[model samples]
Target chain A: MATAPQLPTTRPLWARSPFYFNSTAHLLRIGRGKANNLQELLEALRLCPDSSIFRHTFQTLEEHHFIKEGFSNDFSHWAFAACNEVELAERLAIIDVREFTSIATLRDRLVLIIEEYLQKNPRAATRTAMEPFYLMDSDLVVVPTPYVARNLEEFADGLHKISIHSIYYHFIDARLRLKLNNNDFSIWLEKELDLAQAADRINRIDIYTSTLEGVRQNILKIIEIELATPDSAGPD
Target chain B: MKDKNPDRKTAVEEKNAEKNSKARDPKQQQEPATPAGQAAPQELAVPAAPSGTRERRFRQTDLPARVIERRKHPRISMEQPLPPAPPCLDDYVSIIGQPELDEIRFLARRLRGKTVKMVNSTAVGGGVAEILNRLIPLMNELEVPTRWDVITGGNDFYEVTKGFHNALHGGEYNLTQQIKDIFMSYSEQTRQRMEFTEDLFIIHDPQPVGLVHSKSQERGKWIWRCHMDLSNAHQGVWDFLKPMIEQYDAAVFSAPAFACQLPIPQYLFYPSIDPLSEKNRELPEEYINKVCDDFGIDRSRPVITQISRFDRLKDPVGVIEAYKLVKKYVDCQLVLAGGGATDDPEGAVVLQEVIEAAGDDPDVIILNLPPWSALEINALQRASTVIVQKSLKEGFGLTVTEGLWKEKPVVAGAVGGIPMQIIHKLTGVLVHSVEGCAYQIRYLLTHPEFATQLGKNGKEHAKENFLITVNLKRWLVLFQILLGMAKPNATI
Candidate 1:
């Protein structure tokens, strides 16, 4: 009779609210800060608004998503394309945006990279760019789409159908907006569904290697895999 | 349908009734019909009210009512019976896909009940009018009430505005006090005549930039939409116009490089083309062959074409030079075809120069097609082996967009907004000189597969970026931001 103790039953953790999908539209505007040379660029990097930094980094991915091979951020592209600073461009491009959650930290990293490069090569600071870097930012309007996902199955379907802009809003843009080190999908997957492994797989998606559409496909694949497991389902 | 201007309709109806009554009665017929405060029709001694005086009086008293009439029913601007229904939001789903259309609908849904009015210089000739012709209907279809009005001006006013247009495109022009006065006088007249009652007013280009002076008295947000390149604008012209531009709540440019430093925010909006329109719609092969035969274009030989106005800024002469260079290596025929606009007084002069540069080459065909020959132009573009847009200065190089949308390999100048459309061998080729353009043309001719790939890529780029749906979405987003229904989260 005392051979086995009663074991607790495994239960699911469900979210209080469904995840409402949202798409973002941008109203791009010229920012006050601009730069003609590496010195001015560094100064602008320090003084430009946080939104400008976000635009040059995160929004750039969406803007130039069609291009297969290029720098992922505007600063690197400008450094290489405008200033012909190959080493500097490489360094700037290597500063992954996903490594930081906030724009302030991103700005610090950008400033630090440029400052270090300038300290070593003093003449590079005065090197003039072919075209000036115009700091630009956008007014982000998040619109709620009709797509809503209450569980993993619905999320998989939503991923298959949502616009690329919605994917961008949730995956890359939410990190800065929500001050999370991970994307919206991963956070929701972990916090609501208690699916940490699937969430970690989604977070590991390489943004630089893929387009927004590519990212959507990868996310869909991960979600589909999770949905295939018997334990993926929650209580009816 | 409800009558938009009931008062004017009533007046017209009363005048008609009085005339009918006079015709019915012998005594009344004997008495000359007279306006309420004017002399009778039989009073020849009054010298006919000094030519336009009576008409001017009628206009001044009832101008606002007429404007309201035009705004409520856009068909009044044309004075024609209502035509067939225009392509709605669903019509665009075929071109831009369902998701894109859904996004536009979502944004437009948030902008419901917001009224928009677009003011420009012309209603017949240029790209702005053509856009509004299609855009207004689509916006109304989305439940966003939109109207378009063309500001009227005399030849003197138009001449000054043309000069300003050139200057803003980086050409030299003297901005004298007389010119400024002329522009302001016409602007003031237009402001008085038109009623600005919409929730958002988009005043396009510098001709109506002065209309923003009425913004303080009006109850709406004003936007100055500059469709020209202002990167190297003449300082004096920009100085004269800057104050008025600053009065707007925002400014929109066709490209980012065209924006200038200003206190108000500036937006980047690429001018778009309707894919389902006559100029861009797909055609039958037999019809294309007939169009080519009508234009004396040989279908057997390779045809390289450039479709744009014969303006010096478009560099039609440079295009001919490039064609000549390419002709040395590749035995291809070159077609330079375009139409003139009412606003461009210099078109004839440039067309003459282009003809001279062509120098009686039988292979070089220059057709001065009328503006209504959109289908012919479309046929010519579709029949082309390669498309070239060699402009020294361009606004947005929409011709390049058109060619790319037609899925023809394009070689465009690396100036203004051309670079935005042609991504240097990715979407299409970008060249800086006549020699470079010629070299690319020759290269594309030799490597047919590469050219085909470029065309495919170019079409996809145009589809993704420069469609009318994209333009509609941007506009709705801007309206939402202006109405304070959506906050622009600029800062983290």
Candidate 2:
């Protein structure tokens, strides 16, 4: 292989780095302690001895190899969500959809990981958060497929050829639901900075990209910038 | 710009005698027609009241008693010290996290002696004033010398600016050349009298947006902080204000989406609450009980509360409608808590409508609180079973953040920054209509476990996201970036 495989490694800068959280679950990890209740959390905050406070969020996406029932066998994907289509999630413990909808919930589930799960599926990694977790490799990987192409143009062309393949539609609904849930922060972005206009764009925008995947990628990229955008210094 | 001498104070008092005579003349005042098209209120001929009098709490500022009094005996421009810096932000480690602490430290070190001045119209009312009260102190404590100054204007000036405020918030307001002339004249007056030279001068909202024209007459890097939602700004008004806004070095907005077609680098700035402030602080049982008794609220009952200024935009009437729907399905009390801002003329009118909407419903408790009632505000939030912020349009709903801080599950309108706080079914619920609000409230009250979890999650979210420490970090990063000490694309 010309490129090394993308694997999960701890984020290097996270260490000796100030703690940042994506959600409330990360807030509970101060003093290497978890808040048992809201009162306890408030008390801890009031007494929190650290002089500097900052917010930073971390996510780890790892590739996993799983076999299909027939035809094309092995495939790899990077997900914070549990996989079920290829029975990979079933191979591990089943994730109740109700319980694992948020970043906080996923962090909690990762905390209670069984030793067997890590051993059997070394690639079945959960994103570690808040506390000083090890730095992980972020190099992205693509799993080998029988439909692999020769180049970027060839790969895009090959994907178009398989546009109607069942593989693409199998988990489309569930993936779309998760994206809708987690990717809607554009609406709440504050300041006299209102997203009313951007929201209008979301509704009115026509697909100008070459493919649905291309449009999804563009949307995701914009979301990354919007999410990374800092809060306004303007009035509430 | 004002130079004070003890001897000049005596002369200034003499000038007041002359000015006071003119202040009493109705012909001397220029009354701008109300933008909402209501009949102009009569200007009171009485001498403006003493600064701290009980009557100072009156609603309209068309001719602020204080402003009239000040014009009568115009004193040297005095630089008032803001509230002392609250406890060091470093003390908030477990809450704000460490990343914020490091950034503040870095920015403070970079801009050690630089002075930043903030100017706004009203000093007491509105979100801009409320946020500055807390933010100035925090910024000062972080070792950034910051000052907050209010622009001096009269009935004609503030009324005109109020029209601008309404127009920016999407109301159909037309700025006649007469109003534009008054705005520029007053802004020029403020520009001449006040010191506009600082490392950074933040002109807030529309009231002070005209102050940028003063930049030509002064020396300072100016950033206009617009806190109103202008997504639906009336184009006529926007066109009139665009050139004036373009005079600033940069513009800051509360949300990225509110960024218009401005030709300046715009930074997103979110407002935050001081965790240690009276409004968000943990209250003793004694204080909570006393407040509950005072308000006739039974803490044991399911209390659904909304704390916001009694503005039409806050939709207090809509809240009443939602409360009535919830009351039909389940037994619960709705507490509509808020007060009038000194600068807003429309509060009293909207408040009357809210009262009329409430009628004789004993279950609906409307406590119209006054300014400086932070403890009572805190107690009401603590006593609440669920907090609601159902705004029709919001810049960023601070009340919702406050509710979430108190560990109360909030049901807020799915508008503006409410979605940032509620996160729909995760921290709290976001609703679009009265029925939806009622449905969510009923769902929460009937399901205590779900509500409790939501509240817990909300408190954690507020702790991480909406606290002042997080805001300070972002602000410091802004300072560093502007000063060329940090990456322009820095994520604080």
What TM-score does chain A of each model score against the native chain A? 0.91, 0.20
CAPRI verdict (incorrect, acceptable, medium, high) for model 1:
acceptable
Listed models, DockQ each: 0.44, 0.02
Candidate 2, residues B1-492: lDDT per residue as tens digits?
Answer: 221111113332334333333433446533321112224334222222222222112233344454334322323122321222234454565454444355346556777888888887766545676677667766777678887777778899878877877887788886799998998898888788777667888888878777777674444577888887777887888888889899887777765446576777665566788886657766667767666665666666788999998898888999999999999888887888776633345776676676678765656676655554676788889999989999988878889999989989899987777765665675788888999999999999999998987888688677656787766755665565556554421111
DockQ of candidate 1 against the true complex: 0.44
- With a 3 Å backbone cut-off (N, CA, C), the pairs that clash in candidate 1 are none
Docking class of predicted structure 2: incorrect
Poorest 10 consecutive residues by lDDT, candidate 1 chain A: A7-16
Global Cα lDDT for candidate 1: 0.77
Worst window of 10 by summed lDDT in candidate 1 chain B: B47-56
lDDT of 1 by residue, A26-122 (tens): 8677777779999999998888888889888988777666555554788997788678888999999888788888888899999999999999999
Residue A70, candidate 2: Cα error in Å is: 31
Report the Cα lDDT for candidate 2.
0.55
